[model samples]
Target chain A: MNVTTVFINALAAVCLVFALIKDTTKTKQALKIAIISFFRIFPTVLAIIIIIGLLSGFVPESQISKIVGENAGFRGVLTVAFLGAILHIPSLISFPLAASLLEKGASITSVAVFITTLTMIGMVTLPLEIRILGKKLALLRNGLSFIIAIIIGLIIGVIL
Target chain B: MKKMSKEKQKKGLVKDMLFLGIILAIAIILLLIFPEKKELVISSSKGFFMEMILILPAVMILMGLFAVFVPNDVIVKYLGRSSGIKGIFLAILMGAFPTGPLYVAFPIAAALLKKGARISNIIAFLSAWACIKIPQELVELQFLGLKFMITRLLLTILFVIVMGIVIEQIVLLSEKTTKHEQTS
Candidate 1:
């Protein structure tokens, strides 16, 4: 296993042990939550894995880079950002999907913006957010996030 | 309401399964047609599947721990009292701990508003909840590596803080004008 894998698993194990020591019932409850969520998200994860496979098998690297690579420019970046904003993929799944694209030839900018928008703005949840948080704040948050997501993507592109 | 959500959950699961079925069918058909590419597709998919399976349980465990240990009331208690720069940081920090989906945070944010928390803090809390959860960051680190994850994270925090203040100012300005009109 890689360092990232080891570190995260270690962190989780340590936390669970401490939690178990302090409160057995609560720790069991946490593990229950973990199992439920894991099963809940499993099907979606499989779908994403298959899609990544299809992408590598069928799609050409040239096409991926042309659409989202460094030379794809501002318009290309915006397209991915907009796609990210609208698509309802789980944020966890989006990382692997994103990494697949990056490995193929996608720009750091496109991937960055895509992930940022995917996590930050949810078009599907807008109405509920508005009803709860009000129209102004909801709209402003989404709108501003769209902008900042691009900015963040561009900055990451420059840095890395 | 409870029945409706359970129904929705059932529908969501059905939809997810249906989607997976369709994609799986398509993959099988395509593989049968282009047998040469089967190895390539399976290898790539397996690579990602392995990468994801390794860390996801860990991520979920962390999420579960946060959900049970860090109560929402605790968030409301601290975020309701703080103000200024520290409040902004605290809001982000608190947001990072909780592991629910973003929609879950809206009601909490609304309650904090009613509790007289600063608008900026509430905004910061919501945005941070969206992008900066701890488990989510670890997944990003695993997939995207440290430099990409850290840089994007720092940038997100910076802009989220700015957006919070900007939106609060606009809301306050509009409130002031409305109050002026009422007085007039």
Candidate 2:
């Protein structure tokens, strides 16, 4: 494995050992939670992998760069931002796919915007958010997130 | 409530599985049609899958540890009492902790609201929870590079603070207008 992978796994091992030392019961509970989440997220993870594969394999790199490349302009950024908002993939799993996009000719700005919007605003969960947090807070948070995501992406594009 | 949530969770899983099935079917069909692209598709996916498999368990373990140790009530109790600049930071810090999905934070945010937390801090907390989490950052760093990750992180923090201020004002303004209409 690579450094990041080794580092992450090592960190987890240390934490797991610490947890076990502190309390076996709680550690077990943690493992249980971990397993549940692993299984729970597995399907979506596979789907994302396959989707990324198809994206790289089927779609031409020229088209990707053409649409979301450095020259795609504000329209490209907006499209990616909107797509990020709508898509329900987990943020953790989105990174590699994003990297693939970046390597395939997508602009850093578009990718950054895509990640920000994907995490910040969730169209699929809007109803649930509204139900729990009220219409005012929910709508305000989401509406503001969309605007800020683009702004953040644009600023990042300029800086980096 | 627990039963309802459990049922909802099951439905969500089923939906995910169904979605996966559809994608798998489509992928298989496409692969069959274009045999030449199979190697590219599989290799790329396999590389990514390996990366995910290696790190995901660790991430999940960290999440689990946080869930057990940190607990939601602690966040609610502390964030509820916090105010001012300190409160804002605390909210962001606590919100940045791994706590399952964004949906899980909604109830905590609502609880803080009920306890009279500042809207701006609440916004900060929610935004941080949404985009800035420790595990998520690690993944981003691994794939997107440190420069890109750090740059986006800093920008997100800055803009989120701005968004908190603007949204707080708008929310308060609308509240005032509603109260005025009701009284009138």
TM-score of each: 0.97, 0.95
* CA displacement after TM-score superposition, residue B103 of candidate 2 (Å): 1.4
True contacts kept of each: 0.84, 0.84
The per-prediction i-RMS, to one decimal, reads 2.9, 2.6
TM-score of chain A of each: 0.99, 0.94
RMSD of 1: 2.2
* Structure candidate 1, residue pairs in collision: none
> Compared with the true structure, what per-residue lDDT tens digits does model 1 show for residues A38-100?
988999999999999999999999999999998889999999999999999989899999999
lDDT for each residue of candidate 2 in A1-160, tens digit (9 for 90 to 100): 8788888888889999999999999999999999998899999999989998999899999999999999999999999999999998889888989999998999999999999999999999999898888777789899989998999888888888
Model 1 lDDT at residue B173 = 95
